[model samples]
Target: MTMKILISDPNKCNGCRMCRTACAIRKAGVCNPEKSRIQVIQMDECDRYLPLVCQNCEDAPCIAACPKEAISRMDDPVLQTVIDYNKCVGCKMCLNACSFGAIGFDEDRGRPFKCDLCGGDPLCVHFCEPGALTLKDSAMIQYDQARTSALRRTVGIRR
Candidate 1:
């Protein structure tokens, strides 16, 4: 099965962090961004917030850099990349290899963690009030391109 990633449009984010809260609640049974797998980075100067999560890259650098071989991909339809916490040696290699800054340090365990798309359902997307996040297949890239082009045109005309 083909795996997909959810991208957040900075233009659509309002810095509310509802996605983060939802993720934490779903994964850890709490409502905290610090424990949440997803992170929302806000650029106050630009009036924008960008939610970051694992992109599930086909050639994932994190998986390759893992010396302990703790990270591996599941064969499920959603194609989740999961980490074997038992095998993890508390190394930060995966944390450094991820291009999107998706992996975060688990302070309690001194290990790294990231979004596994909530086992395919993606709790973040379900709780996102602004609909800023959506799971899209590879085929949806063209749709995203078109949407961005239209937005650019609208902005250009306004200016």
Candidate 2:
């Protein structure tokens, strides 16, 4: 089985954003959501908060979209996708390819960063007290996603 995968419960999420803060601290050594691998988007009209993170897709398009060969995934005991910033040209191609908008910019290095799942122990899960975020099985996540998709249709922009 794949490693623990991050899941977001939009119904329980109120856009509190403690997950983002925790992620930022764990990854960046400071509290900066801009540098955090995980991000949250708040929809006031819909009264929802959407947490975005790297999905570690089996067929990750971001890996293919990177012309510099900067993005790649390891298929060993744990499935992990890593980005070589030294090789990344910051073309934002991966950003465009990611459907979840999980990719974020690093102003200091001029490179793109994304969730590496805190090296397997996600701090976001520890910080999310309301149970809005948790690490779940990949298979269960897929089933939940399929059901969620069938529940509603995308009417506006695909992005």
In terms of lDDT, the best-performing candidate is: 1
Which pairs clash (backbone N, Cα, C closer than 3 Å) in model 2? none
Residue 10 displacement (Å), model 1? 1.3
Which RMSD values do the candidates have, in order? 3.8, 6.3
Ten contiguous residues with the weakest lDDT in model 1 = 1-10
Least well predicted 10-residue stretch by lDDT in candidate 2: 150-159
Tens-digit per-residue lDDT, 1-159, candidate 1: 445768688888888999999888888787768889998987688769999998777799999999999999877656578889999998899989998888988787788888887776898898888888988775577777788889989889532
Candidate 1: residue 135 Cα off by (Å): 1.4
Off by over 4 Å in 2: 77-79, 139-159
